[model samples]
Target: MNDKLRSKIIIIALAPIIFILNIITKSYPEFIEKYYSTGLDRPIRQGLSIITGVFPFSAAEFLIITLVIILVISFIVLFIKIVKGGFIKQLINILAFASSLYIIFMIFWGFNYNRISFDKIANLKIEKSSKEDLYKLCESLIARANTLRSKVYENPKGVMTIQGGYKDVFKREASGYEAASKIYPELGGKYGPPKRILLSEKMSYTGITGIYMPYTGEPNVNINVTDYMLPATAAHEMAHQRGFAREDEANYIAYVTCSMHPDNDFQYSGVMLAVIYSMNALADNDMESYKHLAKTYSEGVRRDLVYDSEYWQKYKGKTEKITNQVNNTYLKSNGQKDGVQSYGRMVDLLLAEYKKK
Candidate 1:
């Protein structure tokens, strides 16, 4: 075949291959869940972590290095091309290359969607458990937390010291992405650690939502007008630090751990939040109660939630819309039916697990 015809054929073939992969991924959700939840993903991440630990460059430093190398190489190539051909030819070539890169990026993003469906989680249904039973489970979790807290106070001075609290614990937990990448090299991507933890910020499409950068270890927990939600977000990030990649598992851990905490604020926030899910599971129509409880939050928390909603609304551009669509598609391909909303499905899992115990 001619080169043009060959290229067309290759592009045509790509779609079917991606489709097949998506089907396979969706077909075996359990397998993928097991692989991630078990320690299977750890070895690759751990090995890469050792190398990065030794090198020790911050995220910004690494970005600077990458940009410098790309610019230097691009300048050298352009200079050579200009000398050999002409300025017009080099400019045309650069534009063509840039266009091609954009196309490739879009195509790869589409494929990535096929590989990681979110809808499966959204579609999952759990057997309904009584509120009393769930509350009992919560009490058990609280007891467990008390036990853990006792352990923490065993070295109370050491655990609560400024060095340990702000420096060590925070630093270690924040290094979640680095640690995950070290253990699972395949999961490593261009973004390393996230640059910032944007709190109470609005997201683009959802108007109000939380986002965690699983690849970068950045936690942007955008909650709607609720100080009670902050501790859960913190606990969610802590779950990521402990290597729980699935959103639902992290949510479950966050709810349980925070509820168990000694601080009243944290416990109140955790229990109240869990009640939202418990109601969802049990009540036929509880949106009224949900709204009432949500309104009970302090004005400060409500302000944060509103600011967060507005923030995302302001940034809801074409880029974000495209990103959401692609992400939703990807989640569906991976076994999640409701796309990103599947993250909230953890409520069912948490209820089930609590009942089992």
Candidate 2:
């Protein structure tokens, strides 16, 4: 009944209120589509991105680092408090913090989860694509990738390399989004350009190429990956920054934006990303055909894939598995029923678009 205890109870009460409102929003995707997605979220997302875009470094990354330090300090403090048998106050503080985060997330970007999917916005008719369709898509993408590999610069080892460093790549990436906005105007605005992660090597170990921080509306890219992957990864995160929440749709948008880009490097990167997804689906369907088509990759493309594979191979361990599980759970909690498998849905979008072409 003391002031502190009453405050804790009120904070805990807000959690169920937030949960019920979330359920109401989820039940009416149409309302969210018309009001939140097309109306409120767009302006909110744009305003945050524009404000944060002016900075050279990522505010989100800085916040993350600070949060980590705070967490570490909190654990140390909490341990000492428990040793002193002051557990009640510590528990209340932790609960209050957790509830506050849930509410803040709801206000900032979590409600966007209840909005109509990018599938509806893009009018994509996703279904179980036939094996033949997937195979053809892979073959076509491989050919396109091969053509693009020839135009780009290569390292001494014959692997494709970006002509300029990641800083230049970040500058050029906005052009793709500009082109994409023409096709789907929602993705077209002046958002914050992608920020390179200083801890990109650590990020790569978790299998994350890029991430969109909704808190700051910034797209943070993992530049440690190969040049061919960088452009698409940046574009993909930019897609999320623009309010395309679905992973597959973001990937498709990245492909569209990068392919529409005039630069051959961007074009190749877009095609290469799509090809990888398409080939992956084919591998699951028919390993023999997948191997046969994979064998058709040009020497340059082969070397590039191998290098990319080997780079990731070194990081395949407990941390990567744990991260994957966390990501899977996160996706599921956000209404992605397929969880981590939702990523494979990008292949469906790819097939739908390719069939149209």
Candidate 3:
């Protein structure tokens, strides 16, 4: 076969391959969770930290750098070819076509394969556990968190050194993870799990991002735990390590798991999140209770929440605002109502499940 004909055949074959992969990924949540996302992501993140050094450059940064280098090289080659005459234009055309194909494939794979759809996964379970069962599960987690909280708070200074700097909080969190592992060996593995956690040294708009499992094939999670967030953000990412992919499920699991754990820091982090969400729930009904709960939170948690909000607010630039508006429209196009904000609705399902129990 001619080279052109072979290229066409390859493109045709890729279409079906992409479709098959999409179907498999969408249909097998547990398989993916268990096989691809069941290890600690801290070490991968730590390596990324070292590789990127203190600069905190992201994948986006690397991509941008790569593109710039390619463009520069391409321009130089094309200019030389133009000066030489003949095949220069053809070469440039081939390069442009290849670059375009690469971009299209990236967009296709990103939207279809990279994105997580928890609602679809939840629906796939044949024997749906009752809400009461979920509640009981949550209760057990909460009980465990309470136990851990007492221990950490017993000698807070010993476990955590609060000297006011942001690095101090990172150190404290790292210590808490170490303590949790010592207290519960099953949760924190040796060597197999990530050793050092990576914080997006720069601020992020998202609450937290991390790989559910680093040893597994899953991607690393990168938490947007700026200096202002409550300790809960660390525990929340840890919940992802435990195999909760759904945002609300992660939030719920983080609260319950941390609450149940033997470490005081983990317990406090979990309860703090629960209190925040529960307060939001109560605000829809009892204003007085919401106010009381609001007051109950420590100044640190409140400040963190406020900081988290402000960070996102800054990113609402005109370009991002317009992009978000279009993105919401696109999300609604794909069976999600309330557009992108529907992620927060996971709380409704969690609350209902808790109440039924």
Best by TM-score: 2
Q: Write the per-residue lDDT of candidate 3 for residues 43-108, one digit (tens) a residue.
A: 443443344434333343444456678777767777777778755454645455454554443222
lDDT of 2: 0.83
Consecutive 10-residue window with the lowest summed lDDT within model 1: 153-162
lDDT (tens digit, per residue) of candidate 1 on 1-357: 677545555555555564576466555546544554234433433433333334333332344356568667766778887778776545544444444443443232222322222223323335655546554544454344333333322123222112232223223333333334453433233322212223334342443344443322334344333233555665565554334545555566566555555555455445545654554443433445445445444443344345445544665677677777786775554454421222145655665556554
> Model 3 lDDT vs. the true structure?
0.45
- The estimated TM-scores of all candidates read 0.45, 0.92, 0.49
On lDDT, the stronger of 2 and 3 is 2
Q: In candidate 2, what are the lDDT values of residues 1-357, reduced to their tens digit? A: 999789888987898899889878998988977787667787888899999989999899998888778768767778889889877787777778778778766766777778776666777666666788888889999999999889999989898898787988998999887877787877777677899888999887898888888778899998988888999999999888877777777888889999999899999999998988888888877999999999999999999999999878987888888999999898888787641232277888887777867
Best prediction by lDDT? 2
**Whole-model alpha-carbon lDDT for candidate 1:** 0.45
